[model samples]
Target chain A: MSIYIDPAVASSLRGFEMPEKLGFGKVMAPVMFRAVCQDGCWSRGELLPYAPLALDPAAKVLHYAQSCFEGMKAYRVQGGGVGLFRPERNAARMVHSAERLCMPPVPESLFMDGVRTVSAYCANLVPANSGESLYLRPFLMGTQPDLSVSTSSTCEFYVIASPSEAYHPGNMRLWVERENARAALGGTGDSKVGGNYAASLLSVARLKERGYDQSLWLNPGNRRTVDELSGMNFFAVLDGELHTPALNGSILEGVTRDSLIELARDLGYRVREREIDIDELLGQVESGRCEEAFACGTAAIISPISVFGDGEREYRPAKAPGPVAERLRAALLDIQEGRAEDRFGWMQAVEAVGE
Target chain B: MSIYIDPAVASSLRGFEMPEKLGFGKVMAPVMFRAVCQDGCWSRGELLPYAPLALDPAAKVLHYAQSCFEGMKAYRVQGGGVGLFRPERNAARMVHSAERLCMPPVPESLFMDGVRTVSAYCANLVPANSGESLYLRPFLMGTQPDLSVSTSSTCEFYVIASPSEAYHPGNMRLWVERENARAALGGTGDSKVGGNYAASLLSVARLKERGYDQSLWLNPGNRRTVDELSGMNFFAVLDGELHTPALNGSILEGVTRDSLIELARDLGYRVREREIDIDELLGQVESGRCEEAFACGTAAIISPISVFGDGEREYRPAKAPGPVAERLRAALLDIQEGRAEDRFGWMQAVEAVGE
Candidate 1:
C-alpha cells in the first residue's frame, strides 16, 4: 500500500528543531501519519504535517469515549539507524482495545505502515541517549457526528511522535488503592482505552495528596488481588524469585511487562505469574521475604518501588533498585539501544528518510 | 455574567430549516454555546454558530477520556412558549461529573447561561409534539495537549442542541447481563462521564445479537442487586407500588428518574427506594407479583421492559406499559408540556428570541 506524502510535511520537518530537554510525551514531532475509516473501509494512508484535528462537536469519541491508543518507541540504534521495539505487539493490542469499545480495528498492515512511516521520517528526532527515544503514539477514535450511545460508523487513526528522555519516578511510593478501582471487572480494564485512564485520575489525585508517586491498584472484582499500576505492570522480587500478577481479565497486558518476563526467563531466573494478594504481599514486605518491587511500561522502562502505603501503615521493601531490577532494566535497555545482540528477534529496523 | 453572541449566529439561525423527520440527537441546532477554561480561571461565555471544533490530536479528552456531559431538553409548551425542566439539577450534576474526571466544573451560573442561551435561540426549532423537544447536550472536556496520565490544565465547555423526536425503544427486551458490568463499584459509574457509556457498548452489542434491546446491569461489586440500564435508571411496579434501586454510588442519578419519583409520591403512589435483588425480582416476575418494569432517562422518559432474557429462560412482565408507568409518564410530561398545573415549581420558562 502506497502512502500519500503531504507536500507541507517536508517543510515542517525541515523547520523543526530538537529541544534540549525532552520530557516524556511533551514535545511532539513535526510530522504525523493519518488514515480515515468510514463504514469499515479504510482510506489510503497519508503522511502529513502535525496540526490540530477538526472534529464535529457531536463526534462519538467526544461523547461516548470510543477511542483507543498504543504506545511504542523508535530507537536511535547502533550506527545511527532507527529500530522499533515490538511494534507488532502494540498493533495487536490496539486491535483488542478497539474491539472492546466496538470500534473497527486498524489492519495490521496499515498499523505497521503508520508507525514505520513516522519512524523513518522522524529518525532524526530519536534521541541519541541510551534511555531516550522517539515515542510513537498511534491512536484511533470514532469521528461519527452523532450523539448516541452506540458504535460509531466512522473513525480517524493517527500516529504522533514525541522525542523524550527517560521518565524515572525515582523509587516510587505506591499507595495501596483500596478505595478506587481503575477498571471494572468484566469492563474495559484489559484494553488500552481512555475510559480506564479517565477512571484512574481521582485515585492518582488522592494519592498525590498523601505524598505518593502512583497507585497500586487491586483487582476491581475482589479488591484483594494486586492488579497493576496506573499504566505499568507490577513485579515483586520475592526471595530470589520474581512474582507478578497473572493476566486477569481486569489487568492490562503491558508490552514491556511481557518483554521483561521473557528476558528474565532467558537469563535463567524463576518467574511466576499468579494472583498476588495485596495483604499477603504487604506481609511479605514486612517479613523481609519481598526484597524489591518495580513497575514497567514503554514510557519508563522500569520504575523501582520503595514503599507501599496501606491504610495507616507503610511496608518498606528491603531494596529500592535491587540487583534484580537493575539487571533487568540494563538488559532491556541494552537490547533496545543496540548495545547487545537482538537474540529475541524483537527489533525492527527502519530506513531513515532525510529531509 | 453577559455572554458574547457571535455575529454569524443570527444569520445561522435564520437560514436554518428543520428537517422533515427529526430523530433523537440527529438534527443539530444552528448555533451553540462555548467557553474556555485555562488553569482554574474561566473565560467569558460565547454563543457561536455550530461548527466543528479544532482540537490538538494530543488533547487529554481524546487520549484519557477526561470529559463529562449532561442530557436535557427545552420543551415547546402550550401557547408556543419554551420551558426548561429542572435545569438546575443538571447543572449541579454536571459539576459532580466534571469533578469526577478531574476537570474543572462549569460554574452553575455558566452552565445555566449556556443552556438557557442555546435554548432561547433555538426555541423555533423545538418540536411541537408531546414527546418531542429541543434536546440540549452540555459537554465539558479536557483540551490540554500533554499526554501524561494526569489532570488536564486546560478545558473546553460547549452546549450543543438537537431538534429531536421522542426516543421510544418500543417494549424493550433486556438481557440479564451476567457476564459484563457497565461500571465498577469504585469507578466512574455514578458520574456522567464518557467512560461509563464507553464501557457499555460491547455489552449492548452482545445483547443485541441475542435479540435483546438493552442490558439489565447488576451491582458491579455484588453482581446481584439491580443497578440500572445503560443511560437510564431502573424501576419496577411491584404489587401496585413503585420500587427503584437506591442511590448506591454506582448508579447515575437521573433527572427524569428523580422527577418520576417525586411525581409518583405526590400522585399518592407508594415509592420505595431500596436494593432490588436480581434473582428475587425475576422470581416475582415469574410469579406475576411484578406487574411491569420501566427505564427512565431524559431521552426516553419511560421505556417499558417486556422480557427479561436470562441464561436460558425468559421471564415476561405482566404488562408492557402498565397503568403505573403510563400514569407517571403522563403526569411528568403534563407538567413539562404545560398541560397540568406546575404545582411542583419544576418548569423554568425561557423567553424565545424571534428571528
Candidate 2:
C-alpha cells in the first residue's frame, strides 16, 4: 500500500491514554487516516495525528452538505488479533452515497487501505470484551472553497477511530413519526449521506421529548409503509418467520440487516423482505402475532424494540429480546470476534503494528 | 450594537483589493462577522479578518448536515452609503431553518449585529453598479466533536461577504424535473438549509447536461404542481396577470418572490398566488395565453425563462423578457440600488466605518 505515515502519528499514539469509561463514539483514537481528491484525481492516503481540520469558511461541505460516511468496527479477535467485519460492504455503500451527492467516490482500494491501516495501528484500542470494538468511521466530504450552489471541485476523505464500549440502548421504544419525513421519495434517503441524517434530527428531538428512544420513520412517498429508524434497519419476528422492509429506493441497505437475514435462514428460519405497513405491524404486535421486533445497525448489533408509541396508543411486542434476536446477535458476534469458524468468510484480519 | 471589532480588522480591510472580475459569490471580502454558541447561550458578535475555520474532524455539522444559511445583499445605498435590504427577514428565516435542524437560533439581536457590523466594515466592498452588490451570507452550524447521531452541544455562527456582480442566467431554459425531488412534503424544503441544496445537485447536474439552465422542481407529494426552481421562486404572466405558486410547504418562501408580489400589486398589476399545475401552465404557454415566465431570488432578482423542456416536448413562452418582468425587475433594482425612494422601509442603513 502506497500510504504516507506522518512521523508525528507514532508520537501521538504513544502519548494517548484510553480512559476507563469509554462510551460509544466519545473516546476518539489519537491517529486518523486522511486523503484528498482534486477534481477527479485522488491522492495517496496518509496516516496523520488526529487534529482539528482547518477548512475555509466557504467550503462546499460546510454550506451544501455534500458529504457521505460509513460505520464499521474492528473487533479484537480470539488471540489479540483485529478483524474488520464486512468492511467491503461499507466501502461499496459509501461509493453509492457519494454518487448520490455528486461526489467522487473514494476508490475501493483506498477505502480498504484506510480502514485496514487504522485498524492495524489501533488494534490495542479495540476493547478486549464481548460486544466491544474499535468503532471506525470513514467519511468523505466536499472541501472546495466556493459558495456557488454546485458540485464541489475538490474533496477530502478521512477515517477516524473511536475506542469505545458497545452501544446498549436496552429495549428501545420507537415513536411512529407521521408528520415530518426523513427524506423525500426520490431524495437521499437510500444513501448514507449527511443530509438524510440532518433532516431526521428534528423528528428525533421531538420523539425524545415524548420519552421515545427513536423515530420509526415511514416511507415518505406513501406515508403508510414502514421505513427504517434514523440510523438502523427494522425487523420483526412474526409467526415463526423473520420479516423486514425490502430494499426500497428510500430504505438504506444496511450491512447488519442483510447479514442477520442470511444468518437467520441458516438457523432454520424463513426470512421475508417486503413492505410492512405501520398499521398492520402495530396490529400484529397488539394481537401477539408479532412475537418480537428489533433494530439493527453497525453501532448496536441488535436492539430489541419493546414498545411502539403511535400518537396516543402504545403497542408492546410479545417479546422484547426474543430468542431469535438473541441467537442471531450471538452468532454474528461469534464470527466477528473469531470465536466461531469463519464459515461465511465475513471477517478480514489485520496485522497489528509492532506485533 | 455590542459588537467587538477586532484590531486587525481595520488593517485587513485596508490591505484588501477588489478583484477586476467580480462574479457572483466568488470574490470574497477581507473581513467577516462571527459568533459562538455553547448550549444555547450566544457570545458577543465579532468582526475579524476573514480566514479559515478550525473544526474537529468529528464535528456534527460535517457528518449530519446540521447547518443552515441565508443569502442577502448589501447595496451601495443613496448618499454614498451602504444599506441592507430586509435584513430582519433573513434573520427570522434563519431562525426557522435552525429550528428545523434542532439547532439553537441565533438571537435576533445577535444576527442583526453580525450582518450590520460586516456591512459597516466592508462598506467599500459593496459594488456600485446597476445589478451589483456585496452578497452577504449568514450561516449557522453545529460544531461539537462527537460521532453520535444527535444535535451538537456547541454551535458557531458566521456572516461572510462576497463582493460580486449580479447572477445572470440570460433567458433561462428550465427542465421539468420528474424523477428526483429536491425536498420532501414534510421535509426541510421551506427552510434555507444545506440538505435541500445538496439533494438538488444531482438533478441540476443532469439537467445541465441536457442544455437546461435549471430544474423546475415539482411538488414532491403530487409530482404535478410546480414547487419552484432549485433556489429561486417561479412566476408566470398568464392572461395579463402575474401568477406564482402559493406558499406550499414544499416550496421555499423566497424574499424576492414576496417583494415582487407586493411590488407588482402596487404597480397596478393583478397578482395571484396559487398552485401552478405544470401541465396546465404548459398548455397555456402552447396556446400563447401565458405570455412570459420568470424566476426570482436574492442572487438573481429576476431571471426570465425562455423555454421549458419536458420529455421530448418544448414549450416556449411568447415573451421571453416580457414587459411585466422587465418593469418589475427594473423597479426592484431601482429600489435596491438606491435609484428610487425606499417607500416600503425595507432598506436598513449601515453607517460605514470611519465615516
Candidate 3:
C-alpha cells in the first residue's frame, strides 16, 4: 500500500525514549498514521511525527461528537515477530460505526494499511512482558468546520499507538447502574462511537465515588437485562457454564468477547449467549450459584468481579477469579502471545520496518 | 471582566468581509473568546483572532466526546445597539450540560464575560434583519491528552460567533422516528451535550431522504409521548391553547421554549407543559383539532410544522402557520429585535467596542 512516510518520522522514532513506567495508554509512540477523506474521496495514508492536530474551532466533531474509535493491541509474540489479534473485525466494526454516524467509512484496505503501517514501524515499542503490549487506537472524526448539526463533508482518520501494561490488574467492584445508561436501544450502542463513551463517564464517576471500579449497566430497553460495563462486555459463570449477554441492539459486539466465546467453546466449556436478567444474576451471585463474574475488552483483557454493589446491597460470587475465568484468560493469552499455535487463525503477522 | 484581548484581533476584524449570502451558522466572525482550565483552576479569558485550535491527538473530547455547547444570539436591536436575549439562561444551561458530562462547569461570570466580550467585539457583524442575529456558539470540551475512560483534568472553553440568517426558513415536514432514539431514558438528552446531537443525526438523515425536514423524536422512556425534534423543542396549538412536552428527564429545556411559554401567557394564551402522546397528537392533527405545530430553538426561533409523516400515513395540521404560531413568532421576534418593550426584562444590552 503506497503509504507516504513523512521525512521526520525516522528522527522522531530514533529520538524517542521508552519510559520506565508504561501505564495503560499512557506512553504514546513517537509516530502516528493519518489519512483524510474529503467529499467522499479517501487520501493515501501517511505516517507522520506525532503532534497536536490543528482543528477548526467550529469543526463538527467539537460540537456534534461525530467520531468513532477502536481499541486493539499489537503483541510481541512468543518467539520474535508481532501479531494483531483479529484486526479485520475492528475494521468491519469501525465501518459500521462510521455508517451509524453518517461519516464516510474508511475502506478495509485503507484501514489495514494504516493499522499495519503503524504496527510494523512501532513493533519494537511493543512491550515484551506478559500482560503488556503496544495498544493501538484507530479513531475517525468529522473535521468539517460548521456549526450546523449535520454530517460533515470532510473527515480525518488516525491510528496512534501506545506501549503500555494491561489496564486492570486486580479484582473489580461494580456498581449496578440503574439510573444512567451508556447507550439507548436503537442507538449508537452497538457501534464503537464517541457518544456512547461520552454518555458513560458520569456513571463511571459516580460508581468510583461509591467505592466501585466500574458500572454494570443494564439494558436501556428493558432496564433489567445485562448490557455491559462502560468499556467491556459482561460475563458470568453459573452452574459450571459460561453465560454472557446476547448481542442485543444496544450491546457493542466486542472482538475479545467474540474471541473468548470461540476459544471457550473450543476448550470444551459450554457457553450460552442469551438475555441474562440483572436481578436474576444478582440472585444467583448471592445464592452461590454464580461461581464467578467478569468483564472483558481490548484494554482490560479479563477483570474478575469480586463484588456487585446494587444500591445499598452488595453481592459476591463464589470466587473472584474462578477456575473457568482463569483457564479461559490463559488460553486466550497463549493464542494472542503466540505461545500456543494460532488454531483459530486470528493473528495477522505484521512485518517490522528494520532500523 | 479583565479579559486578555490579543493584538492580532484588530487586524482580523479590520480585514474581514461579510459574505453576501448569510446562511445560518455559515459566515463566522473574525475573532473568538477562549479560556482554559487546568487541574480545577481557570485561566483568564482571552479574545483573539479566530484560528484553528491545536489539540493533542489523545484529547478526551476527540476520542470520548466529552463536550457540551450552548447556542445563543446577539441581536441588532430596533434602534442601534446590540442586545443578548436571556444570555444568563444560556450560561446556566451550559453549566448543567458540562456537569452532566463530568467536565468543570464554566463559572457563570466567566461564561457571561466570554459571550459579552465576543458579542461586543463582533457587534458590527450582527445582522439587522428581524430573524437574523450574530449566532454565538459557546462550547466547552475536555482537553486532557489521556486515553483512560475518565473525566478530563484539562478543559477548554470558547465562544465563536456567526452572522447568519434564521435556520429552517420555511414550514417543516417531520418524520415520526420509531426505530432509532436520540438519547436514552437516563442519558444526556436533558443536557446540551455533543452526544445527544450526534445520536440524532442518523434519524435526521433518514428522514431527509424521505422528504422530511426533521425527525419527530419520541420520549425514550416510554417511546410514545412526543419528546422533540432533533435540535429544537416541540410545541402545538391544540384547541386554541398552546401545548408542549414537559421537561421530562429526556427533553432538553430550550431557552426559546421557556421564553415562548412566558410570552404566550402574557398574551392571554393558556400554555400547557405535559406529556403529549404521539399517536393522540397525530389523531388530533388529522381531525383538525390541532391547528398548527412548530419547533423552536436559538437558530430557528419558531419553525411551523406542516406535516407529520408516520410509517404509511401523513397527518397534517389544519394550517402550517396558524394564527397562534404566527402571533407567537411575531411577539417573540418583536421583543427580541427591540420592536416591542422588553417587558420581561430579558434583553441584556452590550456596548460595542469602538473601531
Tell me, by DockQ, which candidate is best. Answer: 2
* Weakest ten-residue segment in model 2 chain B by summed lDDT: B346-355
Per residue, candidate 3 scores C-alpha lDDT tens digits across B292-317 of 99999888789999989999999999
Model 3 misplaced stretches (Cα beyond 4 Å): none
Best by the lDDT measure: 1
Q: What are the chain A TM-scores of the candidates, in order? A: 0.99, 0.99, 0.99
Model 2, C-alpha of B248: deviation from truth (Å): 1.8
**iRMS of candidate 3, one decimal?**
0.7
Residues B1-355, model 2: lDDT tens digits: 4788899988899899888998888888998899999988888888889998999999999999999999999998757888889989999999999999999999999999989988888888888876888899999999999999999999999999999897888999999999999889889999999999999999999989999989999999999999999789999999899999998788889999989999999999999999999999999999999999999999989999999999999999999899999999999988887889979888888998853
lDDT, residue A214, model 2: 95
Q: Each candidate's lDDT (Cα)?
A: 0.94, 0.93, 0.92
DockQ of each: 0.89, 0.90, 0.89
Give the clash count for each candidate: 0, 0, 0
